[model samples]
Target: MPTVHLLDYVAGNIRSLVNAINQVGYDVEWVKTPEDVKNAGKLILPGVGHFGHCLSQLDKGGFLEPIRQHIEAGKPFMGICVGLQALFQGSEEDNNVPGLGVIPMRIQKFNDTSKSVPHIGWNSAINTGSDDTKNESFYGLRPTSKYYYVHSYAAPYNPGVLESDGWSVATATYGEEEFIGAISRGNIFGAQFHPEKSGVAGLRAIHAFLNGDQFQSLSQDLVTGKENGLTRRVIACLDVRTNDSGDLVVTKGDQYDVREKSGADAGGSVRNLGKPVDMAKKYYEQGADEVTFLNITSFRNCPIADTPMLEILRRTSETVFVPLTIGGGIKDTVDTDGTRVPALDVATMYFKSGADKVSVGSDSVFAAEDYYRAGEKLSGQTAIETISKAYGKQAVVVSVDPKRVYVDKPEDTPHHTIKTQFPNSNGQSFCWYQCTVKGGRETRDIDVRQLVQAVEAMGAGEILLNCIDKDGSNAGFDLELIRDVKASIKIPVIASSGAGVPAHFAEVFNKTTTDAALGAGMFHRGEYTVSQVKDHLQTEGFLVRQFET
Candidate 1:
């Protein structure tokens, strides 16, 4: 098998990239030291986290010169996400740090006032640098295909800027902001998207680059979308826990209760839905944009290193090409042997095991409370901050468990209250989303708005806004709750729980500005597949990414 050298300079879900590489008939050789870089014929640099940190680490490890030499020598090179950002002159994210200056451009942050900060979802990477009338594909990037992107900073796509300099560019639009999605010139190539998590389309690009298929004449039938932006993401979530018989199973809860109330077992056993890894693969095959796993039981009795959840993530990521988010028990803890482990270490373990993002649940609630107590000041010691700083804000997701607290008026409590369309039994029309902890068993004094704002300030990239009032209800998403949460912060918000059918997803997308919608019970019950939901979205005239084989 052919070998591709990967610079293992930082911590990330590099395993997925390796899996993608192996799937395309190429073997990965780790460039651990500067000496290893010399032996690399086809080098791939994957960057995640802060701009300064990625460059500084590369500089500190003595890899900058070797990488520079590799590029100067005209060796085949590819960069993913921040790895793409590393080739530019510098970035607004870290002005003090200098980039490799291969592209002769500086990266800038997206206009967050117009859209979400990280731009987390799938977007087009069409080769817009073609000089002729023909639609040409570069590095297997098609105008009709979409790739997964998650970042706040990118090289802004200015017409003819890179092309005049003998460079190829593929651009993606985010709320009127056209940015460089993929760029290539000579033997140097870079992608601001995560090709490994981009399904078969991404695999094809990886294959093309590895096989030296730089410019492919795309079929004339293939055309770019007339209206292109980020696609509405549909995620399949699996709530995993050990059942009563000590078997790990994917279970869905009604308002956080996993036991059946009127079945033959009649609340005597845990509702075992399916195996975690199997269900995840099924959803992936059904064209789910992403798969998420929440270990409900927290793996309390086992050591962190030996937990089965890591195995689940490893197995799921091997086949599921989209992003994989792992939640539950991501907080600081003590090992069985009495060694203290921080939450960042816990999250790193999952990242190493192939999780693209780590979801912080109760830990985030605690961090938010501490923030309010400290007069809304940030403590750099929090798990979200540490992980975000190390792996970029896009890798850290704050899973919010919130329930509605009805009130007669806005003055009912000292929290952000919204007038609701659905009144309570007491005829209360105003309510506040009270943040919860311990899987919705404990309620905190803080509200959803406060928690989201605090965490976003602390560097959280996305919010998994799960409504305790809607979990397993199968009615629909709490639109009021989703709208209120969306109004509070600028990061991507994933609406989870209370999805009964495909229309539920459509309704959420149509009524609110949710970045993504997640289905747990509806998908697990075998009532509807992820493809069905996507089909429904397409039928409604919304832009939906088709699942590629």
Candidate 2:
């Protein structure tokens, strides 16, 4: 467990900083004074207020000297917002105030008015380095990822550092001048934008820094073993099913139980033969770093793991080598006249069948008793954990489908009793949705938040949050669900269900602290390729997965 030191200064958003770092699997300690930096494994300086005020606080707190010492010692350090600009010689926002001077540059105001100040919204970075060459910092990075830029001044481009775009300024005003939006000097990295707030790209960049050599080398050499320049990831999903002819087709399910419950038709269901592969290819072309194929019908139909379907995927993967995860019919135990087989064998089969990861849904939830029994029987935490330890957490995914159910209230009236639908502030007068299993057929009063925490405790590395309300609706993600789940859990969350467009991906990343986003309908219908989505996200300043071809 590596430790990350977050500088607590006047300009920093302490909560956002802590949330971002924790999302990437690291422990964070608040460093409000110079002494806090002395024994830090890695140091993060995040600022939100005025640059001059931030500098003054840093000096008063005596952090400037220790920070310099840490940087000179080749320790991994990062500067965000004003914290980033403060690392340069000085900023125009406050005249005569000196910066860390680690990079030979000064920040200046953008005198243009065509574009608004603070340069809000999303922007792309054009890699100034050779397109054919990539460094560890840029690994798994798409051409562009959405970065939230909020600044009036920018750092001028210098050849001594690698720039993401040709606009010399890290960020610039509409038509006036270019300024540094971000900067990197060996082990020291600075960003004009708040990566924590920047969404998935920001998270990916942070993760990369934590996992890359720069952070590793610094952490190793400095006894903290942390480096800079890591970013977060945004993912897209495509759900594949079989048509009458046994050819792979794409369709969306309705509310996760339309077929099982009220006999409602599967919303967005369509015959999309050979479309999933095409959409996946397009996502790769568009710069999607990774894509997932959720065989939505595998478990329902009890069909033998689709070998031909996987073969098509294997062939498609050759052209676009992004990480692929497949899920649906993974059984850990089979009862045939009291005979049982280990689920690890099924997982191994998936790995050999060309999946980078395997997801367990109904099997895990419906068989909780079995898993609990197995854990006791096998002397482990749970059956899932036992299998995960064998295959590695990265290779195991837990799919959680939760629905919102209103808590009974005396004032609440049935929808059929109302003449005109008047919406309440609480939205339908409902309380909270609990965790649902067995394809949304069984609603457990168990608290979803508690369940999320429990799963993490059970050794789940990641959670695929699929909203039963939004499933196959093409209505967009349930922001409330994503936001609540994100706030409550520290593990990376993959937001699934109700993704209608590429912008939806941007919105999810921008609005919540979710790590990766998953979609199926949009990709299945050829609505947007993963590469196209990545390109859009990259233009928005998101760091995405890059494809060589």
| Backbone steric clashes in candidate 1, count | 2
Candidate 1: tens digits of C-alpha lDDT, residues 47-149: 8878888999999999999999999999999999989999999999999999999988899999989688888999998888543368777899888888999
Candidate 2 lDDT at 172 equals 26
Candidates in order, TM-scores: namely 0.98, 0.52
Cα RMSD for predicted model 2? 15.7
In model 2, the runs with Cα more than 4 Å from the true position are: 1-232, 257-270, 273-278, 299-313, 333-339, 367-383, 408-430
The CA lDDT of each predicted structure is 0.91, 0.61
User: What are the candidates' C-alpha RMSDs?
Assistant: 1.4, 15.7
lDDT of 2 by residue, 1-549 (tens): 577888876522244456567777888887866888988868888775466777877888899999999989988888887778877788887876788876556777654333323343334433333233332224222334445554556775555354432212233223434445555556776777666644466676677666653321111222221212223355667667776566676555567532222335233234453566776667656655456777766633333343455665555544444456677666655543344546666666555554655677766664454433455233343545655565445456678878765534524522111211323456655445467766677876454665665555555556789998788788888887877777776556788899888788888888886767877667666677666767777688865544433
